[model samples]
Target: MRRVGREEPRAGRAVLPLSLTLVSGILDAVSFLGLGHVFVANMTGNVVVLGMALGGSPDFSTPGCLVALAGFVAGTVVSGRLAGAVPRPPVPALVVESVLLVAATAVAFAGLTPGRRFAAIGLLGLAMGLRTASIRLAGVSDITTTVITSTLAALGARSALAGGDGAGWGRRLGAVLLLLAGAGGGAWLILRWGPGVALVAATGIQAATGGAYAYLSRRRP
Candidate 1:
């Protein structure tokens, strides 16, 4: 019974991060496909796009990328501070993220005017930044929620094929698959209904994840 009790909470720790990763994928799809070729969650992609824009690529927007990058930085700073001050950082940080996502969804529903597009990009970027920082503070191993490059590298590096005992491969693989699934589903929804619908779905997921995390945290001993 004691071992089972400890293992259950350990298992529960992965839930919030995985759910947030799915939200990241959906937001990335919406921003890249619907917004002006920008990535709100994936800063690595945003940086590359920013460079391309600087290199005179008409397909990307320098200002939009800059806004997202700036927003992400701001969110990280804010959440880092919040994490330092609070006992349970993920709860409040997730609340802030949810609010930002809701605001972004509203901006999307209104219209994607040039101004509104930038606003949505910044809001989504900020929300994702908060999520990244909060999850880092939560100390969940093997999941980053927003980016999965390292997760993939670690998965391959420590696999049995690499002459090492394969540990954590399942969770790493699941993260990769969920990211792919979220992107594909989000893209399909955007194509069929529009970015507004996809944003709504993402926001709902974030809100629900936050609620679930809070509930589970309370239940944990």
Candidate 2:
């Protein structure tokens, strides 16, 4: 395994990306269901919504989608800078992501009026953007945390039917399942309690994931 400061080889690891994929699903569900039908994690969906809105879809908000896209780009830039500055462990980026999620949770509890709801969406988008960028910088594989289209393609290409040994199936399948689980759980929380509860759960999980990574790094010999 390769090591770089506090960072260890994360490629081919299922646990971290699986957990982060779960986080993505939770945030995306909350963003879509609770925050004006926006998508914070999935920019492709957001862009599609923007196009639809421009094509006269009353169900979508063009401004909201644009705001989310902009926020995501900003978050990516910020995360890139953070990673370059730290260049060792990824704890700083993860902590910043958690902070963004926490802010979103606070916005949810504060009530989603006109401005506040959009603010929450932006925050969620920013957090997800940061996470995706950080993961890419860390050189992980078989998981992008938010996007699964490529992962699905990879799985299909390497399946037994495709004359391949089905390598990396566990991580690929686990990512998809975890994402589904997180989305279901987020939706249930939104229906049973409210957005506040779901956001809090997502934030808590994100923080816990970061802490766990940090702990594991310290234990590495």
Top candidate (lDDT): 1
Per-residue alpha-carbon lDDT of candidate 2 for residues 109-171, written as tens digits (9 for 90 to 100): 988997998899888888888878877776654488997888889899999999989998888
- The candidate maximizing TM-score is 1
Runs off by more than 4 Å, candidate 1: 1-8
| lDDT, candidates in the order shown | 0.86, 0.82
- Give residue 170's error in model 1 in angstroms: 1.0
Error of 2 at 166 (Å): 1.1
TM-score of each: 0.94, 0.93
- C-alpha positional error of residue 44 in candidate 1 after TM-score superposition, expressed in Å: 0.7
Cα RMSD for predicted model 2: 2.4
Mind giving the per-residue lDDT tens digits that candidate 1 earns over 174-208? 89998998899899999999999999999999999
